[model samples]
Target: MDVVEFLSQRIAEDEAAARNLLNDRSVSESGKWYERRVLLECEAKKRLIGIVESARQAALAAMVRHPEGDTPWIPEAIEWTTLSLNALALPYVDHPDFERRWLGT
Candidate 1:
């Protein structure tokens, strides 16, 4: 497969692994272990975001290099990047400080 397709597959695999780790029951059974797992998951998610962003940038660069091509993968790259960003934001969704800062009265 081409570079964009390869990158997409890699991102999918990484996301699946992260989800598996997050859902593992062993990590949930102990308070300290759960906290550590959460931190590790957060770090994994951050790294995945960086990977997706880099892939998107590479895809954009490829499109620039081949402006006349179909460039069909751009939309997928953008969607994945946006999904990752949204996921990264989810842990903060219930934070009081975040709510106060962004949804102030």
Candidate 2:
């Protein structure tokens, strides 16, 4: 598959994994043992995921309605996805590899 198709598949997989983790918060808690603060952070991540999903759906609908290229919806969907991914990584900002992994520093 092309890069775009590969990337799309990866994103779908990542979103699915995030949803699974959100559903099974107990597994994560057992691994890291987060307190109330982290629980709230998880909730925020869940909301971000929802936002990303909504943006993706909107983009897909737009693509279907207007097959003629050059639409702003694609970029808007990308922006939402990037912002949500960044927010998802915020809880790990203090990690040693955060800058290298997430920020590409």
Candidate 3:
């Protein structure tokens, strides 16, 4: 698939994972502190999605502006998509604040 299509699919997958993580009752019921932290993480994921969407728009605009020319915008789009995926995965992986707040460390 093309870069744009690949990035779009990645973004969709990340969004779904974020939604599932946020809605997980086991995580939510960990503790009061954990619940609050997960809520914050959910908010962070939402913000990341906004940022990714903005980047996607910019990339599309760039592509349109240079339709028959060099495709330099693909790199930017991929970078943004990667960053967004990383942001979405942060809560599940490692982060001091996430550990302290979500895991009650």
**What Cα-based lDDT does every candidate model obtain?**
0.58, 0.56, 0.56
Q: Per-residue error at 63 for model 3, in Å?
A: 0.1
- Alpha-carbon runs more than 4 Å astray in model 3: 1-30, 79-83, 86-105
Please report the TM-score between candidate 1 and the true structure: 0.50
Q: Model 2 over residues 1-105: C-alpha lDDT tens digits?
A: 322233344445455665566577476665434333445554655666666777777887887788886686687786666655654555555644344344433
In model 3, how large is the Cα lDDT of residue 63? 79
lDDT of 1 by residue, 1-105 (tens): 333343344445555665676677665546545555556665676577678779878878878987987888877886676555555544444543333222222
Worst window of 10 by summed lDDT in candidate 1: 96-105
**Best to worst by lDDT, what's the order?**
1, 2, 3
Judged by lDDT against the true structure, how good is candidate 2?
Answer: 0.56
**Candidate 1, after superposition: displacement of residue 67 in Å?**
2.4
Measured with C-alpha atoms, the lDDT of residue 18 in candidate 1 is: 54
**Which candidate leads in lDDT?**
1
Candidate 2, residue 12: Cα displacement in angstroms equals 17
Candidate 3 residue 60 Cα shift, in angstroms, is 1.2
Clashes of each: 0, 0, 0
